[model samples]
Target chain A: MSGTWINLLIDIIISLSLLTGTFFIFSASIGMLRFPDIYIRLHAVTKGSTLGIAGIMIGAFLFLYVEHGIVSGKLILGMIFVMVTSPISGHMISRAGYHNGVKLWDKSVRDDYAEAVKEKRKSIDN
Target chain B: MNLQIVINIIIALMWMFLSESYTFSTFLVGYLLGILLLFVLQRFIPDSFYMDRVIKVIKLIILFIKELTLSNIEIVKLVYKPKLDFEPGIFALPTELKSNWEITILANLISLTPGTLSIAVSEDNSKIYIHAIDIPDVVESINDIKETFEKAIMEVTR
Candidate 1:
């Protein structure tokens, strides 16, 4: 917060991966937009966005450390947690949606899970 | 539970640091805020309930690594075979575990290992059909896969 605005601008400009990181975030956003099914979208939302956002936030955080000397530990720590939890949470939500009887898109191939469960139950009951 | 998640975040921070990108303030704030936010969000998102999520995850990773190492060796041996070492096909492996988390871990572990792909898991979470690179002794391989991975999932998630 203490650095001059121009100095901060220079610091932000210099970090190359920050741009790359932004690019990943863009791809993730596009993936979310383009994917047809909730399941497919969940994959993007979880894996792509999680990694993308983590990269961007971490890149931005790196900029702060070099420029402002703020060396903000809290934000970096938050990024790590987000990286870990986001995918797990995302996967869980998708799984729940599947289990709670949300149907997959019609064009999707392989409903093996449904048949497997049905046969398993038939065997168990018999 | 919140406290545990916070601890998990702290542990994660140590990992990030090892990767050597440290915004000391960002790390601190992110750890606390991320855990807090995740816990708040957990309430609204409905999912298969997992009481032993952390343990289950750890167990899954360990089991997957073991399977990967073993399968890598298997792949190596098959590579040298003179007469096409495998007749690959898909088979359904019976699974009793119903938890979505556990089933996914099972599928992922299968997919992660060499020579196997978890093509499908039953919606009711009973059987998983996997395609093996070498469909040798379907029952035995299925058992090995289950014992190596699914059992661990059941033990932890149960």
Candidate 2:
């Protein structure tokens, strides 16, 4: 009887985490569609997706731990890998976008890089 | 680095005994077990900067998680709004951290956050070029990165 109660508790926890994870992921996709530019959109994709995936992984991990009593190191390692890699990929894309001269939004308040480049060019020409 | 790897492997082998299994699973168990054991052993093992660095790396991971969450919320709000009105710009941030690995980690951390994306590293590696969605004030943004990420990184590696 007590085992059943404990299982029910685990089920509820898992469901709650799953729901929350799904919501974050939903928010991420929505953000991707709505954001104005590549850099900003990249932000939405990386941070939201990382945390959303984290939530799902945590839920799955908890369920596995409670149900099987087997602490799967693979799941934890997978989570760590995801957490580490997403940012690196995001960095690569954003850097490439910038290097390719992807135009910033019209309302973008600053262009420090452009100004810096021009200054270097002037100094070299002199 | 050599000592750390050696300790990690021994811990992994010990894990094989505890779990009563010897396979790839032992390696995984060893890695985790090494972390836990090193964490405890650090207190007794005088001058063991090896475990200290591992612990610091773990702290960095925790810090990254907290910042990641905050940035996610910020991005979500911006997305949910009717119009995106952030002040975006690419600026150069001077970094004191020298190592290639340290610089890479710093860049990744910035890119992972909501508003900032690392664009380039200067030829001299003295500055990291970042494109941020909101840079209303240059000094404020620079200080934020220095205080939160760079400071912790300096403690860990440099």
Candidate 3:
């Protein structure tokens, strides 16, 4: 009887985490659509999706562990891989966009990078 | 560092074999015992114990997770807002991290947190160009990064 109750509790916890993870991913998609520019959209996709995936992975890990009584190393590894690589890819895309002169949103208040580049060029020429 | 890990693992395996149980809990108990043994004999160890670095690395991971969750909520709120009137811009942040790998980790951490994305690193590696979704105060944002991520990283590496 007690074992059945514990199992039911684990199921509830798993479902709650899975629901929260799905919500985060949904928010990422909405933010991607609504964000004004490529750079801002990257923020939504990278940060939101990273955390979203982490939540989902945690849920999956717990489910597998409780049901099968075995630890899944791959789930933990995949979580770490996503956490490490997402930012690198985001950085690459944004860096390329900036160098390619993709315009920022019209209301962007500063462009310190451009000024830094200009200063470097002037020093090289002099 | 590698030697310490190997010794610890050997100790764990010996414990499992002697107990005649190959379960994870048995291994974990043995590992803890090994750590205790190492801690008690730290005076003769060549350098700092590997567990010190392991604990620091774990602390850094926890800090990153906390920051990631907080910033994700902030992004969600910004996204669901009716109007997107926040200021977004690219700004330069000077970094005190000297090593290449350290700088890379810092940039990756910065990209993963808050409203900021690390767009580029300077040729000399002195500065990182970050593009932010919202920047109410530039100095405050810079200081925030310096205090949290940079400080935590310094603790881990140095």
Best by lDDT: 3
Query: What are the per-residue Cα lDDT tens digits for candidate 3 across B39-133?
Result: 89888877789898889899989888887888799889988999999999998888888898889989988887778889999989999999987
lDDT tens readout by residue for model 2, B7-92: 77887887888888878977796888787777677766545647667778899988888778888887778778887667887778
Predicted complexes: DockQ each = 0.04, 0.62, 0.81
Q: How should the candidates be ordered by TM-score, best one leading? A: 3, 2, 1
Candidate 1 similarity to native, TM-score = 0.44
Better of 1 and 2 by lDDT: 2
> In model 1 chain B, which range of ten residues has the least summed lDDT?
B72-81
- Say which candidate scores most in TM-score: 3
Off by over 4 Å in 1: A1-14, A119-126, B1-158
Write the candidate numbers in order of decreasing DockQ.
3, 2, 1
Docking class of 1: incorrect
Q: Which one wins by TM-score: 1 or 3?
A: 3
Which portions of model 3 miss their true places by more than 4 Å? Answer: A68-70, A119-126, B16-27
Q: Write candidate 1's Cα lDDT for B116-143 as tens digits.
A: 5555555556777664554565446567
Looking at candidate 2, what is the lDDT of residue B77?
82
